[model samples]
Target: MDLPEIQSIDDLALLVEKLKLGLVSAATSDEYEFSDEEYKRIRKILLSNPMFTELIPSYLKLCRNLSGVWQYIKHEFSTYAERRGFHY
Candidate 1:
């Protein structure tokens, strides 16, 4: 699948929706794993735009398959309250 360029929050929302659909489809088979390149691209985007960081937790809750990506985000933006909320 092609990763869309996320210039605005709407774009990110669409990407998240697409990912959720992909997860639903992949659930019938094996786990879904993002390619290394895709991972790097997403990481770069998040790093460059901290405004979109709030979406990480929502994505994690929707798809635990991407825990590694969540870990990276958690590490990069560790807030005690947010981490506690995620754990519980």
Candidate 2:
């Protein structure tokens, strides 16, 4: 499935959730990998937003799976509070 346009932080969060589900499905079926093209698209979208710029580099390096991405987001922004702030 094609990714949706990320117009806000909420959009980004939704994309991440979709990616997580995709990753889980891929792992179970052993038939897919998150393509480099998809990563580039995601990177481009995030870099377009100043609020997400700080996350792109580390995220590119460390976010190979949902758990890694989740941990990084949680570690950098806390699990709940900072994420809630981003949405508002």
User: What TM-score would every model get versus the actual structure?
Assistant: 0.36, 0.40
Query: Cα lDDT for residue 32, model 1?
Result: 60
Predicted candidate 1 versus true structure: per-residue lDDT over 1-88, tens digit per residue: 3444677778776665555444333322235654445544554554456675675655443333444545544674466455434333
Mind sharing the TM-score for model 2? 0.40
Assess candidate 2 and give its lDDT: 0.55
Best by TM-score: 2
**8 in model 2: Cα distance from truth in Å?**
3.8
- Counting clashing residue pairs in each candidate, in order, gives 0, 0
Ten residues in sequence with the least summed lDDT for candidate 1:
21-30
Q: After superposition, how far is residue 24 of candidate 1 from its true place, in Å?
A: 10
Tell me the whole-model lDDT of each prediction, alpha carbons only: 0.49, 0.55
Residue range with the least summed lDDT across 10 consecutive positions in model 2: 21-30
